[model samples]
Target: MKIISWNVNGLRAAVRKGFLDYIESEDPDIIAVQEIKLQSGQIEIPLDDYECYWNYAERKGYSGTAIFTKHTPIRSFIGDFHPAADSEGRVLGLEFENVYLINVYTPNSKRTLERLSERLEWEDAFLHYVQQLNAIKPVIICGDLNVAHQPQDVKNDRSNIGNSGFTDEERSKMTRLLNSGFTDVLRHYYPERDDIFTWWSYMKTVRERNIGWRIDYFLISDSIVDQLEHFQVDDHIYGSDHCPMRMTINLH
Candidate 1:
């Protein structure tokens, strides 16, 4: 099965730029998107084969997440794990026969680290939540986590150090998560490779120059690492500042 993740930045805007077309072409079994920036029922997506699940922030045109899946899950969750963290519409989960897919849009620490404390609190809550889920079954986590994780994960580590997404605290939280038994599928396959990234700044000439960070990811419980068949970054396909990343798994 092919599972993909992307941060559309804004669903309405991405749709105008051929979002549906791209979805139809990839035809992934399951796909999760972050930063949808729309309230529920504001727009309808015409995907007949897939069941749609959405979590919208109370504030309109703000942070949000959604999942589209060809297979119906036995159970789906919009909230209930953590109230305060869930208030932002940043997480949703679907329980399949053997796997639980948790889609998240992690809070970003502001440029000056204004929200760093809150961001860390969210991280702690999220890790605990996922661990609880993993205790039941392997979990597949994906979305715009908003941290570069390692120096190699972003371009210009020296120049970008201490920036919002590349800060030491944020990076350490990512390390703690990975250490807790999740495998970052891309780095698992391409440990030494560099220059490959998922998100780019919207500033002029930044993306053109390929200056980007691998903030979006597909992470799974370590038990399923052997089932991972293919992983890649689709840098060429673009409608938002971020690009889509995909992974295929051999379930048998």
Candidate 2:
């Protein structure tokens, strides 16, 4: 099955900029979208074939997430992580016959690191949540994780070292997640790959020059690593700061 994850920045904006056309062409079996930035019923397009599951932030035009799946899941879970975390509508977990798919938009440590402490706490709780899910079945976790776990994940590693996404604290949390039996599917397939990224700065010539960061990911439990078939960043499709990432896995 083909599963895709994308941080669409804003669902309404993206729709106007060819979002539906792109998804129709890609035709992924399951698509997990982050940073939807809209409350329910604010925007609608004909996506009749897919079952839509959405978590909307209480605050309008802010962080949100959704899953469009062709397959019916056995169960679905909306945010129950914490009051603050749940309020943002950042997580959606769906249980399938064999895997628990979690769509998450992790809190970003702001440029000034103002939310660094809270981001760390979220990381810990998220890992615990994943661990609980994994104890039941293998989990497919995907979304904008909001951190670059390695130097190679971003352009100009030296300059970005202490920045919000590249800081030691954030990177270490990602390391802890990987160490806890989840495989970073992209790195698992292309460890030495370079210049490929999911998110780019909106500044003029930044994305044109490909100065981007690999913040989005599809991580699977280690037990399911062998089932991973292909992982790629679809840099050509554009409607948001982040491009779509696709993974083909043999669920059978």
**Which candidate achieves the best lDDT against the true structure?**
2
lDDT of each: 0.89, 0.92
When summed lDDT is taken over every stretch of 10 residues in candidate 1, the lowest stretch is 78-87
Where in model 2 is the C-alpha error above 4 Å?
none
Distance from true location, Cα of 200 in model 2, Å? 0.8
**Positional deviation of residue 197's Cα in model 2 after best superposition, in angstroms:** 0.7
> How many residue pairs clash in model 1?
0
lDDT of 2 by residue, 1-252 (tens): 899899999988989988899888889999899999998788786889899999999999999999999999998898677665699999998999999999999999999999999999999899898999999999999999999888889988999988999999999999999999999999998899878899999899999999999999999999999998888889999999999999999997
Residue 248 local lDDT, model 1 = 92
Clashes of each: 0, 0
TM-scores of the models, in the given order?
Answer: 0.97, 0.98
